[model samples]
Target: MVDNNWLAPVWTLFQQQPLAQGIGLAAMLVGISAFRQRDDGRFRLRLCLYQGAIAFHFLLMGASTAALSAGLSCVRTVASGHTRSPWVMAFFLLLVWGLGIPGINSPVQWLPIIGTTIGTWGLFRAKGIVLRLSMLAGGLCWTSHNILIGSIGGSLIELSFLFVNCHTMYRMWRQPLPNPS
Candidate 1:
């Protein structure tokens, strides 16, 4: 936990970054809309936009790791539907981790790294319950990271996403499975 004495300064710094806050709010809005998408294809498509907003938000806030993770998420979400090839997924995973190495100043940085890895795998490779469950796990990690970084909007987005994603997954579960060929 951060010392109480330091928090006031940090809060003040956060307050000064109006553009960052605005971008964060925009990211949150886009993310909420993305979560509302019932179809996986549409969800991933919308996520590309959300990730772009979030990446810029983090960049403006000078959170390099988080920004990189969000940027890679855009790439992952955009490429996920194109191929189910393990080779491609593996390449991106390696690239994300490689990019993250230069930015690791503290243990907290690992949160987004691990979280984004799970998200990339789930978004690119998994389907149905597996994808939803992995996303839930990733969301929890991101929520913690966002809180630690004092990203009010990012934290809110993850929390809201957790609830909405879970509800959507439950709806998916309750529906009858489609007839197989």
Candidate 2:
């Protein structure tokens, strides 16, 4: 018989931390909506909301590294909206490594750091399709981390993010390029 015991941990998390899971689910909705926005400003605003919510969700679930990453992401996403300065990007990148390095108990902890680094680069250096593509990569990293950490809502959100981001990219790609002045 196939082992069906893997779900026990997921169920236990649900039973133990229903509130955190609910927050994650809500964050997922916000993130999905964020990607659907055609305007970059709206996308960044909504994504910042998602990052904040997910940070709290990770904190409640005892994923400190992931929480830290998400927290920084919240700030970074907002900053990206205001400026795409390389100096700002460098600062956030340093912050991620500085804050995230000491928490390394296992290799799994690296996922959030790597994801956040890529996201920081994307947010500061790129726009539109390139930005979303970087987010897709970051989502993959988060998905693996969530699954390893037994975060039901976290896993679901990353998985959904991948699909939604791809669809949004396709939509953006179909639009004609804007005329440069």
Candidate 3:
């Protein structure tokens, strides 16, 4: 018989935390919807909601670092909608690093911190396709973290986000760019 126990841990996680998995599924749906929005403001609004939901999902899954990062992401997404101020961006970056550094037990823990950092910079400095590209990079980090942590829903969310984001980017690319005034 071939040793095929690789899925056991993920199966155990799903069985042990059905509620968390449910929330993760919901978060995944919201995140997919967020990326589908062509309007930047609407996209940010939906992303904020998705972040908050994912934060709760992480909390229930006992991923404290991921939870904190997602919570901060919720706030940062909302704040990013209001201003692109470098000072504000700098503050959030510092906050993520300052709070996240103490909790680092392994290199894997760095994933969410780095993901959030990329996302924060993208929100503050980029818009349209560039922002989505940055988010794509961040999603890769989160996807790896999710798989390592045995979070089936988190893994699904990031993978789905990557596909949806790419489609949205393609849609944006097909449209003619606004003439620079």
Clashes of each: 0, 0, 0
Instruction: Give the top-scoring candidate (lDDT).
Output: 3
Error of 1 at 102 (Å): 2.8
RMSD of each: 4.5, 2.6, 2.9
For candidate 2, lDDT tens digit of each residue in 16-113?
A: 99999989888889988988887788989999999999999999999999999999999999998999899999999999999998988999999999
lDDT score, candidate 2, position 115: 93
Q: lDDT values of the candidates?
A: 0.86, 0.91, 0.93
Writing each residue's lDDT as its tens digit, candidate 3 over 96-131 gives 888987998988889999999999999999999999
TM-score of structure candidate 2 = 0.92
| lDDT, residue 157, model 3 | 97
Point out where model 2 deviates above 4 Å: 1-9, 177-181
* lDDT at 23, model 2: 93
- Give the poorly placed runs of model 3, Cα more than 4 Å off: 1-10, 176-181
Query: How close to the true structure is residue 179 of candidate 2, measured as C-alpha lDDT?
Result: 58
